[model samples]
Target chain A: MSILLNKDSRIIVQGFTGSAGSFHAGKCIEYGSQIVGGVTPGRGGTTHLDRPVFNTVEEAVKKTAANVSLIFVPAPAAADSVMEAGKAGISLIICITEGIPVLDMAKAKQFLKTHAPQARLIGPNCPGVITPDECKAGIMPGYIHKKGPIGLVSRSGTLTYEAVHQLSQKGLGQSTVVGIGGDPIPGSSFVDILDLFERDPQTEAIVMIGEIGGSAEEDAAAFYKARMKKPLFIFIAGKSAPPGRRMGHAGAIVEGSAGTHASKIEALKSAGATVIENLSEIGSTVARNFKPVVA
Target chain B: MKLLEYEGKEIFRSLKVPLPEFGGVIDKPAQINSILKRLKKGPWVLKAQVLAGGRGKAGGVKLAKTPAEARAFAKAMIGMKMATHQTHGQTLKVEQVLVEQGVKIEKEFYFSVAIDRKIGSPVVIASSQGGVEIETLAAEHPEQIIKKPLDPVFGLLPFAARALAFELGVPAGHIASFSQVATTLVKLFIDKDMSLLEVNPLVLTPKGFVALDAKIVTDDNALFRHTDFSKRVDIEASPAEREAKKHDISYVGLDGNIGCMVNGAGLAMGTMDTIALAGGSPANFLDVGGAANQERVERAFKIILKDPKVKTILVNIFGGIVRCDMIAEGILAVLKKMKLQVPLVVRLEGTNSEKGREILDRSGTRLITASSLWEAAQKSVAATGGKI
Candidate 1:
């Protein structure tokens, strides 16, 4: 089975009446996703994109048996919306809003752990995920994706699209692709998705796209070196960008902890991951690594 | 946004955190006498209020034993062009000076509250040995440093604060005030939406623990609620970068010969990497975001061309949510709006990218088009005569 999403998953839209919510939800439905209902606080008993709208996610889940939530709530209340979905027992919450306050996310993450232990959150500023052909739960362009054995995870949206399009060009299809968001704190880490990708029998190889930000890539490398049995390929962005170098930067500098591009790349490479030298060559590199593929 | 020393101290002052007696702030040397008149001291510290760090080693900070000395130091500092290791070779002009009463320091310790991404929470970082070279201290004597992770939601609790003060060996009589300092730091950190709140060399004087230096960096994304500090642009960036911020584009200036613009942040960074690998130094990192329409692309081009070092421009766009033909039209419109001296290499991909490429090819401009980022990087670098 494809990880996290499939044709059987029933999805509901939060902030369903908003322009972004309505537009993307409509696109998801057009792509053959099972959009059963929606949740907008005041506009219950209405119909959006031919789906019934409920006032609360709890009510929508109870009535439609919706297990997933696609949230397009604005930044100020985006974290609250995620928590609301988590508390309502929605197993998977995908937030597409950007510009959320870091502390607000920290609190929302804490709430998710303490109150809604069963729920999983994906992004606050990401492109979302697609299981290709079967389902599209995010704002990603759906037509370019094809179902295959390659599983992908990234911190960026368009860059994720680039990898997928390149792979699709080389006749490589993906089992599942996820954008875990590029914020300082994300709802899920690279390891979180890697765990799922490794266990999915359909996913034979994994492509991880990371950038110079948090230590998530390093953490993932640790997990891979110890536990992963599948082949892993990786790319870390921002290698050419300047880093914040200052003696005063030690203000926040923990003793030996760093998230520099060199450190992330070196870590993953040492962990036996094939580091692509050029971003545009990711598809070709994976193609060469995976032999006898039919185009 | 990074807050200057005086700005950070103002927050500390408002929060009632322990601080040395404030003499006053002055921009001119003549104004120093008035501030010196109010403070009770023989020697005062004249700190140049420049955004650049490493002030002590750069002569931006000086001690004045007399009123005349203070004025002289202020005169020398006020309008001084400061270049530090942190400024990326750019000079930061000192426009203000802060005067504070000198205190007898019995000991110095490092204390800070910052978002520790590794631990996934805010943490209390302290060290018995602290100074300008704290990083050096960390490398040599790691055990001297004490780091405690705080509750991400509630912040540092009282018992945690008490334990920290005791562990740091605060005097039993002053442990309560030390705990108060810890509490106020977390309070200000969360309330102000600060990414980092650092009080390096938290001095222990006969009076009490005073934050001798305060450096605060607030989360730029959290500025919607912090409208008082509503400036989302980085104050420390170059002039062109500040201009890009105003136009809602992500731009960072670098010292290279080839300038590049792309659609997304990660892709923009990757473009720079490709440029570097292709034997060209990328002059800047610029992302026009998903909606790279006519006006926005035009603004981005103007910003990129401002740097005198940028000899050639590379435009890499991967149409995701936005269509390729629309961006192609935008680039064409930009060419019409402005005259270009630098050679241009454009690469378009994703949705309807072939149509977009065809539009550019037929536009009759001397623009080179590439099918991929690798080819675009090579062409742009070659256009620079492979000199870089």
Candidate 2:
């Protein structure tokens, strides 16, 4: 009943022969994700994790009819791998590679618009999406997620896990969690995933985690103001972060009076979302908004 | 990485773009004589080589009508700390001054090629109003600027360049030179994997369109492709920053007493926010990243310890892609090798967290453990004598 992914969704692992790909794919499989096959150039005929492997994404898709492609390719070639997955007609592509050059991603985005407009690219430097207890397509720990009505979307990896852990501790399970990535230009945006959560019947409320950088949060706030149907809570990081210096993430920076924590919080507050000042208050804040749920 | 004005001009010259005649860099007043011998004539421009913008307003850029004036300017600029609005008042030491041939008065225009993330392609922006902030120009008179998006595949077409030149109101005689300069700038941007290439005040002298000033920023991720250019990185980064760069970790120093070690940038920042909320200021921001092996974790610990202001350390690991036990092992290894004077608080969650906790417990190090982020922040702040 979750959005984007469920127990029935078939998956294909890109760069499946690599250590990271094989390891995380095994974890996803253990969590009961329907991993149909894998793709690794030149190692096509081989079998990995008891599934068939193909030289190209097209071959993998043609043989196994895989709907989702999870990428673990290196940073330099990640953009091309995304393009390959899109060209092969995969409906959902999740890239887990980081440190990709911004220019390369720009070209890939252009290529996707013209070549594979239907394909929805999630992240090239993000922790992929997870529909708890149904399917897992990312590097997040599968044990902590619980199946429920709250849909979580964030721009960070571990921070999302922190929120999920808190929600679980509060007996508030989640329907789906998507990490939109922390790059200056991600393939998907907060509004894109919010639109999904808004339409999904299973998701009742949403938790959004954002950090300093870009105007994505402001854009999402504007969207929520106009078309929000559910209670959305937010927690932004990097309030005390120094300006002009990048705060870990490539996109987590305060540029010339823009992308400040105050500005982001003010934008979301004015847009009718409850912005939590502390990370520890997210669980209680969401709990207070909705009726008490029986654990 | 931001390149100095002189280094950016080197790339422009390498791409065959027209620029003011080369004048050597003068780091010392004595070097000014050698630079004058290499340059064309009496009148020259001495620009302080600093990374921040608005150097002209800061008096970093000066005109020297005589060699004695050039020597005086170089002496005053070198070893001086120059501040700019971009640097946020943090002064950058001026190590050298660029000496170039002065040009006659004609006209000034702004030209730059940069990645427009919204459009997912390289965008070339040109304005007849030059030597002013582009942001101000865009806000005040947007119609005065000509914005063109270049095709990533086919690149900047000849017709597109001609169109931009005509739209910028370039004289009919200088159209060819303007087009050449524009094309060359684009080529340099693409060839060197540059994120931004700006030629502010693209001067229109009697000769043609010569770049009066240049500023270039190359992509750090694409540095592997350009080994030579990677070696030219001279940002005067902090020592901790330099060490973190060597180990591929992200670290930013702060003026607090609590050092934070966390996995993932988003979580690292969240940890910092939580620490502040718990009534303690973080000494630095260190993200061990998603794959925190023992070596990287050890290096992160060393970098954090190098900051003498750190009074306590907080280690928060969610262990998603990175295993918690691996981080625990790194911590144990660092504790065994070095004398740690600061109190330590560790929080491990998800993916073999029990095993990681067991390792930390068995190590017998004088450290506090927490099962949640809230508890971790409270414990670290309390350990540092900050009320929670």
Candidate 3:
């Protein structure tokens, strides 16, 4: 009942011959994801992890009927891989590659808009998404996630893992955990994932982890205020970060007063979402805010 | 990376954009004569080459009516210390000065092309209320700024540029030249993989529109394609930050006592926030990145130890793609090789965390181990004599 991915999802690994693609694709398979085939431009007709490899995404899709494409291409070619997947009619594309230029992503966004409007691109610099025990399509540690009712979305990788770890420790498992990435121009937004989480019947409550960045968090706050019906808890990191310096992530920069932590926290609080100040307080706050949903 | 004014102008010139005649860079007072010979005539502008913005108001820019005045200004500016609001009050050393022919401005217009993250496209922002403060213009006269989002596929079309120019109050006679400037700027932005290309006060002189000031920031990630431009990266970063950059790690120097090293940028920042929440300030922010192998961990440790203000070091890592035991080994190797004067707090989680903990415990080093981020922050803060 999770959104975007589940047991029926047939995934194909793009850049399958690379070290990162093969390694993580094998791990995803170990966690019960349906990885049917792979795509590597010149390495077609070869096989990796006992799956057939094709030259292009179109060939892979046609041969194996792959519904989703997981990208592990390097930064220089990652955007083209995304465009290739979208043009090939792959509905869901999860890009795990980091360091893609912002201009390339800008072009890819436009390309997707005109070429494949139905395709949903998750991240160009993220850990991808997972539907708990049913399927995994990212670099997240598989053991930490458990199939349950809570939905989680974040702009971070390990921070999402931290939230999931705390939630699992508190006996609250997840329905789906989506890492929308920390890039300045991500394919999906907080509002986009929030809309999906709200529609998923299995998701009871949601936890959003955001940081100092663009107005995505503020926009999400506005969306929640206007349309959301379920309870949501949020944690915005980088409160102690100095202004003007990029705090690790490319998108996590405090330019003037636009992306400051104070403004984001204020926006979320005024939108009726309980914003936790400390990272360790996320679990306790979420637990206190929501009562158990009876089956 | 942020390019100096001269470097940005050189890029614009290469792309055939109209700019003020160059008088060359004056690295020393003696070079002023050579620069003056290259210029057309009198009335030159001496601009200090510093990475910080708002140089005009900070007196980093000066106008000289004669060659002697230009030489004197260059001598005064070179080897001087200047501070700007962008630099957060930190004084930057001016190593070079740019001497250029000053233009008679009939009008000033603000024009910039930058990747708009909100719209997921490249946007060209223009305003007739040019050279005054762009931030103030944006804040007060939002309507005065006309923004046009450019299509990456076909780029900014002539009609679109004409519309933007017309809306920006470009004179009917000057719209064609303005459109040419806009089209060239957009092409430069795309071809150069620039994150930002700004021409503040694109002046309209008797000769037509000329770029009076230029600021171009190339994307560091896309530097692979621009090999020649990558060599021009500014040397304004701190030594430790420069070293981290060499190793492909992210490091930002801070004024605190606890040196925090973590994997993943978001988690690194979260670790810093947690350290502050535990009543301790962080000396710096260092992200060893996702693949924290032994070499990277060792390099990160060296960078952290280079800061003399650090009294305690906290290594908080959540191993997802990175193995925890490998990081533990790297730490042990660093401790064995170097004479560490500060207390070290190591917290490892995720893959092979138990093995990582066992390795650290068996190393017989004087190190504090924590099972969680909170515990690690508390230990590091207490070790640094801070209340938790």
Candidate 4:
């Protein structure tokens, strides 16, 4: 079974009237997501892509019995959407929007600690999650994904696609793929997805694509060292990026002390995971490292 | 984007943080007299405001004893382009001359609070040996650097700041002063939504602590909150980069001419390296994202065409979420709108891949689709008829 989403999981879309929300929600629906309804504030009671719209998340949840909420609100309102979804008793809140202020995320994180401690947050700026061959959510290209044993997760959007393409070329399909996004203060970390992959029976091995930012990679390394059942092949981006130049990813910057490509790579290497620097090397690195027994 | 010292000082001043008196910006030779009238002090610092490092050694910062010398210094800086590590060309950003009484440096100390990606909290780094490069100091005198991790939940507390200050060996009474600066810096950093806030050479003056130089780099993603500072960005950046931004393509100008265009940042960088490895130089690093429309394609092509050195255009798109036909449409649109002259090579894969190639092949703008990245680079280099 997939971790966050599956065919039976009912979901609601926040800010579904917006272009990104509608476009992705339509695609998710086409891929057989159980989109019970949508919430677009003033556009409530209306319908988007044949799903009923509500003004507030609470109202949508009460009516639709939606267990998960996918938020596609703009940057400024993304944190509020997360809080709203959490307060509405939705267990899983996936934020697909990018660029929410870190301060906002900090405040929202505090709120989540008290209000919705049981709820799981996939991202505040992530591409959300997809249980391959089960259910799809977020804006990932749906065509390249196929059901397999490898669990793929990344901090980048298109880079994940690139990794999946290479994996597909190698005849390695995916169990699920999650884009954790590039925001400075993302809700979920690599370890969170790693735990999910470890528990999922279908996910035998994982391909984690991290970038040059944050200590999340190190945290994931710590997790790997402590007790990860599956073999993991990881690729960290922005190795050649100059110090102080924030790579295209918002979170990928070498500032103060923690966010650098080298530190992340060193940490992962010491943790017993095979670390591949280049994107092209991810598949080969994984293929060579993973024994058939792991799958 | 990083702001110059003067700009950072202006932001500090706006936040009601105390700073030394400053003079007006002098853009012309004639504006020197007025700048002199604005300065209350005799000895002033003529600092060139360029977005780069090593400005101090480039003769960008100098002490002028007289107003005439300050004016002359301003004149010398005006219209003179100075290159720095952060800048590519001679950046003409010396808008005004800052005339101020230089503070007496009792000791150079460093302090900065930024997002620590490790714990996802604001990390405060303080060192007794400040002013110089912290990296160097950390390597040489590792004991001098003090690392204090801040809790995102509780924020940077006063006790934590004082403890850090005490660890840095400040006296009992001076701990309060250091704590004040630390707290103020943390506030300013969080309030401004800055990605980095560095006070190198935080000097110990007779009056109190004074910031000798401040370096601030804000997160471009959070620029929407600070429109005033956003408007002040240097518009003189490479034309292609600016144009790519307009169409939402992540583009950075490099000194090459293969005009490599790819669909992802990782793929784009990989493509750039593959080109370089294949003896072809990439003109720029352009990531059109996984969703490339005709408008973005036309914009990418226009930006590529703007580079006269671009002899061949290499378009490599792994069409998964983004279809190949859409990429082909964008390429054709760019070719048609720009009236195509450069030889173009493309490698399109995934999602209606063959149909996309058919569209490009039928376009007749000298398009060639290679089977792999190596083939695409070889074809692009061959099409250029020389090493790019």
- Two-chain complex of model 4, DockQ on C-alpha atoms against the true structure: 0.34
What's the C-alpha lDDT at position A250 in model 2? 76
In order, the candidates keep a fraction of the true contacts of: 0.59, 0.75, 0.74, 0.30
Question: Could you give candidate 4's per-residue lDDT for residues B204-223 as a string of tens digits?
Answer: 77666777777887767677
- The true-versus-predicted C-alpha distance at residue B68 of model 3, in Å, is 4.0
Ranking by TM-score: 3, 2, 1, 4
TM-score leader: 3
Model 3 residue runs over 4 Å out of place are B37-40, B386-388
- Model 2 lDDT per residue over B139-175, tens place: 8999988888888766677788888988989999999
Q: Candidate 1, B193: how far from true, in Å? A: 0.6
Native contacts recovered by candidate 2, as a share? 0.75
TM-score list, all predictions: 0.95, 0.96, 0.97, 0.88
- Which segments of candidate 4 are over 4 A away from where they belong? A239-243, A254-272, A275-295, B27-43, B57-59, B63-97, B149-181, B277-279, B381-388
1 versus 4: better lDDT goes to? 1
Candidate 1: regions farther than 4 A off: A245-257, A292-295, B231-234, B386-388
lDDT of every predicted structure (CA atoms): 0.85, 0.88, 0.89, 0.78
Number of the candidate with higher TM-score, 2 or 4 = 2
Best by lDDT: 3
Error of 2 at B135 (Å): 3.0
